[model samples]
Target chain A: MFFNLKDFIAEQSEGETDWEIDLSPLLALMVTLIPVLLLQTSFATLKMIETTLPVLSDAEQKPEEKKKDEIDFNLSLFANKKSELVMELVVDNKRLKSVTIKPDGEKFDFIKLQEELFAVKKKYPKENRLKLMPGDGVPYDIIVKLIDSSRVTPEKKPMRFVSSTGENLETTFLFPDVVFGNITN
Target chain B: MSIVHDIVKKAQKDSGFTLQLTAMVDMFTIMIVFLLKSYDTSTLEVKNVDGLVLPSSITAAAPEEAMLMLVSKKGVFLNDKRLASIVDNKIEAKSLAKEDEDFIEPLFKELNIEAEKIEAIAKRNSTVKFKGTIFMQADKGLDYSVLRKVMYTATMAGYGDLRLAALDGEK
Candidate 1:
C-alpha cells in the first residue's frame, strides 16, 4: 500500500473545514431579546425609610420613670421655616445640648449636619432614635436628605454598639429609628 | 507607482471571512442570563407619575409588602385609586375635612374602610394581624406642610407605621 500519513490526515480533515455554522437564527434571537430585556430592565432600585408616627393612646396617664444614674440621650432635630436645622439633645426630660446648623447661600448645609450627627454619635454611641421634625417651608427632598445625612456616615461603614442584652453588635444603622413629630399643635 | 497601485488593489478586495459570532453569542447569553436572574417581582414597583419625582436615599431597607399611597403634585392616590386632587401645589379646599384642616376626609375614610376589612380578615386568621403599615411615595417638590397633613390623617386612620419610598442611588 502506498499510503502517506500526511495525505490521509489531510484528506480526512478537509471534509469539515469548509462547512459553515448557521448564525442567522442566533443573531436574530439576540437582536430581538436585547430590546425586550432593555425595556423590562428597571435601572433604579426602590428602598424604604421606615418611621413611627405618634398615635392616640387610651392608657391611664402615669408619671415618666427616670433612672437616677443613667442619662439616656433623647435626640431631636427640628428644621424650621427659615431653613435653620436645630439639633436638641434632651436627657431625662431636660434640655442637655442644642447644636444649630445654619444655611449657606440658600442651601441648608447637609454636610455640617452630618458632621454634627457624627460627633454626637461618637459621644453617645448607643443612642438609636432621632425625632425628625420637618417644619413648614422645608421641601420634602431636603427632609429626605436630612434623614439620610443623620442615618449614614460619608464612608457608609458599620458602627459597633452594645445592645440592651449586653451583646456587642455591628450595624450600619445610625439613628435608624425615626419618629415623625411637630405635626400636632 | 506600480507597487502603490498593487497595494490599493489588494486593499479593495474582500477577504470573504465570516464574522466571528461565537464569542458575541457567548457574551449575549451571559448578559441575558444575568438580566433574567435579576428580574425580581417581590419588591413593589413605584409607578411613574406625571409630576412625581421620588427622592434618592442611601438606606438599605428593602421595601416590604404594604398598602401603597402616592402623594404626587397632581393628587394623592391609594393603590392606583385617586383619592384627593391637589391644585396649585396644595390639596384642594373641598377635599379637606371641616373639623380638621390637616385631615384629608377622603383618604381617612378610605383608609378606615380598608382597616375594617383588614381587621375582619385578621380576626379569623390568627397569623395575619393589622400592623397598619403604609408605603408612601411622595414627590420631592411638595412642602413639608402638605406631608404633615397627610401623615396626621394616616395616624388618625390607624395607619401609623409609615414607610417612605425612595429611589436607591448614590449620595
Candidate 2:
C-alpha cells in the first residue's frame, strides 16, 4: 500500500482531542462584561423619607382628629428666603419666644438648630407637632435634613426626656408630627 | 540525568493540549451569579431618571409602594408620564395651565383623572380605598418652589400623602 495505515489512523485520531479552542473571544467578552456588571451594581439602599401623614377622608376621620386640627400645636419653624431658620414657640395662640437662627454665609446651621431643638425638647417633651414653613427657593435636601434634625437628636437618636406628667420617659422623638405650613403657599 | 533528559524531551513533544476550562467556567459562573444577585430589585423598581440625584438619609425606613412621581431638572414625571417641563430648576411657566405659579395644570389634570379613577373604583370596591399616597422622587438639587407646586397640585387633586424618596445612608 502506498499510504501508511497506522500514520493515517493516527492523523485522523489526532484532530479529535488535542484541540485548543481560541479563548480570546471569550476573554474579550468577559473583560467587557465584568466592568459593566460591576458598574451596574449598587451598594446603596433606597429609602423613603416619610413626610406628614396623609389627610384622612371625612368619613374615616375621628372626631378628635377633626378637632385636633383646630387645636394649636404651638411649635413652628419658618425657613425664610434668606435661609434663616426662625423657631417660634406659641402659648395660647399668643406670641412667645421667637428664636431666629441665621445661617453662617449660605449654609443653615443645622447643628445649632439641633442643639436648640434639644433645649426645646427639654421644655415641651410631650409636644411632637412641628409646623414647617420652608421658603420658596430653598433646596429640597435642606428641608429634608431640617426635618431630620427637628425629629431626632444631634446624635441621630430619638430625643429623650421626661413627660409633663412627671413620668420618666426616654427615647421619645423630638417632633415627628410635622405639618408643612408652606404647602399651600 | 536520564530523568531530566526525559522531562526535557516531553516538553518538546506534542504542543497541542486541551485547556482545563472546567475550573475557569465554574469561576465565571459563580461571578456572574454573584454580580446578578447583588442588584437591587425591591420596592417599586424605581430607576435612575436622567439629571435626578437622590440625597442620602440617616433614616433607615424602607420605601413603600405607591404612585411614582419623578422630578428631574429636565422635567416632572408622574408614574413615568412627563407632565411638565422644567427650566433653570423650575417648572416652565408655559407648562402652567393656570396663571398661578403654584399650579402645574397638566399635573393637576392628570392627578384629578387618576383620583377619579381611584374614586370610581372605590365606589364599587369597598376593599380598595383611594389612599392618596404619592411616592415622590425629586432631585436633591431641585428647588422647594418646584416641589411645592407639585405637592400643592397633588393635594388639590386629593392626593395628600407625600413620601420623599431618598437613599439609605450611613449613620
Question: Which candidate leads the pack in lDDT?
Answer: 1
Q: Model 1 - which docking category?
A: acceptable
All-Cα superposition RMSD per candidate: 8.0, 9.7
Give the number of the best model, judged by DockQ: 1
lDDT scores in order: 0.81, 0.76
Q: Score candidate 2 by lDDT.
A: 0.76
Candidate 1 per-residue lDDT, tens place, A74-95, comes to: 8999997687899998876889
Give one digit per residue, the lDDT tens place, for model 2 in A113-150: 87777787776675788888888888888887888778
lDDT for each residue of candidate 1 in B5-25, tens digit (9 for 90 to 100): 344345545555555568877
DockQ for the candidate 2 complex? 0.28
Clashing pairs in 1: none
Q: What is the lDDT, from 0 to 100, of the residue A40 in candidate 2?
A: 71
The parts of candidate 2 lying over 4 Å away from their true place are: A1-42, A53-71, A158-164, B1-39
Q: What lDDT is reached at residue A104 by model 2?
A: 75
Clashes of each: 0, 0
- Chain A accuracy as TM-score for every candidate: 0.73, 0.63
